[model samples]
Every structure is written in C-alpha cells, then in structure tokens.
Target: MFKMKSKSTLLLMLLGAVVGSLGVTSASAEKARIVNTGKHVDNLIHKVDIRNLSYFDTRFDYSSKPYKMSQNRYQTYKLKRSLKIANMNKHKEVILPKGSVVTGLNDGKGNITYISNPSLSLKNQKLVFKTLGNWHGSLPIIKNNGGAQQPYTRNTAFSYKSSAMLPFLSVKSNKPFYDAEGLSLPFVSISADSQLIYHTKGSKYKPTRYAKIKKFKLTHSAITYYLAKPVKGVATKKVRSGKTHLYRATFKMGHVFQMMFADNDTDGYSLTVNNGRQEFFISLYQLGWKYVGSIVGLTGADAVSPTDAKIATDYVQGLY
Candidate 1:
C-alpha cells in the first residue's frame, strides 16, 4: 500500500510540473506583442446602463425628448481609434477573428487591443477579426504623479463613464452644421429625468482632436455624467469614403462601492466585499448591451457565455 501511494504521489508531482510549464509557455507565447492594424474599420459607441446583476441590457430610451446637438462654429475632429482594457492576469489574448469589423480588448500595461476581422465565428463567442494594433495615449490620472485636478472629489460630482461616439453614417454638409451662438457644434447633451447632461470632445476645435481619458472617478450613486469638448471641424468635413464613420470615441467609469449603500466618488478599481458583489459599470454601445468576450481570471458565474456572444456578434455584424 505504501509503495502504491508513493508511486501515485510521484505521478501527481510530474503532472503538476508539466502543467506549470505549459502555463508559463502559454504566457510567454502571448507576449510576442501583436498589435492592431488599422486597415479595417474603426468605430465608437455609447453604452449606457445602471449596475445590475442579471444581464447587460442596451435598449436605453429616456422618455423626455430626443437629445440634440447644440450648434457651434468650431472644428470637430473625430477619433481614429477606440479602446477598452479588461484588467486580466492571464495568457489568453481576447482573440478576435479576421474581417472588416472593429474589436477592443484589455491586457497588461493598460493596453487597448484591437483585432480587425471580416467573418465572425457563430460557433464560438469570439470577436472575429485580424490581429490589428495596440494603442496608447497620454492622459492625467490620480495615480502617482498624475493629474492634480480630482474633479470627482465631491460626493455629488458626476462620474464620467466609458463611451465612444463614432459617426457610423454621415451626410454631406452643404451647409455648415451650426447651433445658436454659431459657436460651431458646442456640446453633445443627453436628456434624463428632465435634466440635460452636456459633454464636449475638446475645448477649442482643432482639425484633429484626441481626448485621452487619463483617469475617471465617480461620486455618489445617484446619476453619473460624461462631458467633453470635441472639435467641430471634422463634423463639417466628409467622413471616410466607402466607410460610413470617420471617428471613434471611448468612455469608461470607475467608482468605489460598499454594502447596498454605494459611494460614487472613490479612487481606483475598488472591490466591495460587504455587499453581495456590488457591481458598477457604464454601458453605451447599444440599448440592450450584451456580453461578447472576456479576459482571464474570471471565476464561476463570471465565465464567458458563448451563446450571448454569438447573438450580439451576429446582430451587430448584420447592421454593417
């Protein structure tokens, strides 16, 4: 019996070593640093949703009145890229198949992974696209040697969530797109609860404007807000030919939560253990936001649901 037990233990040890080696090899293999190639489509979207436990719903209809843009006389430049980073500690790169579709994923060093693919796999819930490029921008943050302005410091301050507004379709601007002051399209406002939330891409309109989000902090749990002053020139110019949209925007929101009581203004990605897994996230892509893919280190219940991924991919791809 002792001999048999010893042999079994030895076998288990060998198996463990082999598994460990494979895991390490996988990590290194993924580190070759493949990036996004912007040959395909580049786009952005605004995903809005309140934190919930059940599912990601995108259909957002704020019944008051349709939000419109305030006419302004300024240069409006659209973004050339959109990115999202899912903080994951693993080897697997959120693989996107090859095609015309644009993709986004997150990995180490806060890198945005984009895979431009043509055909998606209905069988697998993976984003189908070719391995494109990686993007990095400079923005202020609350971290060490970051931005000095902690705008969301007050408990009542609004949290800016993640959203990218890519003009999917554009019409010729025979006439200048203007508003009241002729300020060149000033702000993008969304109406909610009879209140208007205003945002701009940049302060002064430039030919090409890139608003890099250095840091996002939230305060209170009532309502979050996103504001930016983007340029106005691009909105007047012709978008990409053949392509429907020219620019892409990205939005992300972060806050600290505890118990059923939520605290909006906090610092960093905080995990609250007091409550039953408090969830705080911003959705702007669609009315019924759906999960498509995920990074590693996710536990049970958090496992990537392939069924939902296929449905969303099919639905979005059909639109293009």
Candidate 2:
C-alpha cells in the first residue's frame, strides 16, 4: 500500500512539471510570433510602392485668413488615410491603447495644426480609418547624454487648427528627442482659426489657394504639428500658352517629431501635430514642442514670457 501511494505522488508531480513547461513554451512562442509578424509586415511595406496601397481622405475650407472676424468663421481641413502594410503572415488586429490613436492637422500656410481629438471638428468630416493606432512617437535620444527625456510624449486627444500652409508629410521619430534644440517635427492644434490663402515663390509665380472651413465641437483635446522641408513640385501647365505657370506642389519626408519615441518617456512636457499638408511652411519660433494647459492656453517656450525665458530654456535643456 505504501509503494502504490508513493507511485501515485510521483505521477502527479511529473504531470505538474509538464504543464508548467508547456505554459512557458506557449508564452515564448506567442511573443516570437508577434515579433516575426511585425517584421514581415515591415519588409513587405519596403518592397511595395506605398502610394499604390495608401489613400487619404481630406476636407478643408478655402479662405485668406486665420481668424475671420467679419464672417465669424474659421478656415480648416481634415483628412484621414489608411496605409496598407502588406504582410505575408497573418496578423491579429492590434488595438492601440486608449492614447494610441495618432492624429494630425495642418493648414496650407505657415501655420501647422494638430487636433488631439477626432470628434471635435465641426467643419471637417471624420477621417476614414480602417486599422487601429494613431500617428504616435517621441523624439529620439542617445543613452550616454541621457538626462530626463524632457517633454515626454503622451497620447492626448486633440483638434488641429493653424494659419500656416506649405507642403508637409508625417514621419515617425527614430529615437527619443526634444524639440527645443530645433529639429523639425509635426506641429498640430486643437482648432484652426487660420486659413491657407496663397503660395508665392517670387513675383513671377503665384497661386491662389484656399481651404474650406470646418469647426470642431470638442471641449478637451491635444494637438501635434510637423514641419516639412525638401518639397517636390512640377511646373504648372499653361492653358493660354503665353504666360509662365506656377507649379503643381508636392512634398517629401523632411523630419519627424523632435520628441524621442519611448514608452511614457517624457518627464516634463512636449507637443505634436496630426494631419498635415503636402507643402506646409512656418516660421522658426513656432517650431518647438508645446504643452496645452487647462486655463492658461498652449504652453511652450513661446508661451513662456520674457521673465520665464531662462526657466523655459533650463527646462528644455534638461530634457536632453
């Protein structure tokens, strides 16, 4: 009887051991599968011409000013695009976290706009989205120079609005970085009171461009903005065949967000934009990370007064 009881105990222990091993193996395999799948998707995207697979839905009002006090109206635009990342391996739909939805807004002028919330726009239509995940990332930084990666990036809902207009494109930040040093990143706003009116290179060339207006109805939101350089364009065609034409404008990837991309990496505060135009332009002062406050307004170096310039500088420098 004693021998039989001892055998039964040994069998049960062995069974428990087997189950534990299997659990570990299963978890490891699942992780590997997800990694491999992500890699496969990346590779396929590289091989394909992204233009063929991607489409953007855009809507905006055309006007000549940022704030239209005469009409009591504001100019705006909204576009949403789904980039099909081709993958050979099957991928489960990735549901981004509550803050993972990436969004952007830009005017055709010098003002870049970011809308943190999608549902706030009263003028523009909602973006046509299929997959999950917003345009989200942070500025990149190296380890040796590490301090608190200041202006940490966060997923905030916002609405975008601005007066700047130029060719622009959205990009992902390669590493953790901060914007005060002056690297170009996406600029955004919660609502735009400005409108892109004209594109002028010289007295010889000019085009009358305007944006349709939209209004956002949200109360709380966030905005991100990006600056675009190295624009591409083709000379405009002449119908009369006598006058020299302007050009058909286009833009390429200039720079991504200055904020470094990390998981809740921001220690202080930072800013970003969501949707942008192909050819957007802006001044230097407006090109840094900004934080939105509840009562005061947008916070950043610009928001900081002359008295607080030193404080803002120190705060930005500490981000590095």
Query: What would the TM-scores of all predictions be?
Result: 0.18, 0.18
Candidate 2 lDDT over 209-239, as tens digits, reads 3332221122112112211111222212212
The lDDT per prediction is 0.21, 0.22
lDDT of 1 by residue, 1-320 (tens): 01112322442353321100001111111212111112121121112222221112122222324421111101011122222211122122333222212212222223222211111112112221111112111111112221111111111111112221211111111112121111222332221111122223212111122222222233222222222332332222223424343222222222221111121111111111111122212211221123222211223443345544445445444333
The alpha-carbon root-mean-square deviation between model 2 and the true structure, to one decimal in Å, is 25.9
Q: What is the C-alpha RMSD of each candidate to the true structure, in Å?
A: 23.7, 25.9
What does the lDDT come to for candidate 1?
Answer: 0.21
Worst 10 residues of 1 by lDDT: 17-26
- Please list the residue runs of candidate 1 whose C-alpha ends up more than 4 Å from where it truly belongs after superposition: 1-187, 190-282, 285-291, 294-299
Q: Give candidate 2's TM-score.
A: 0.18
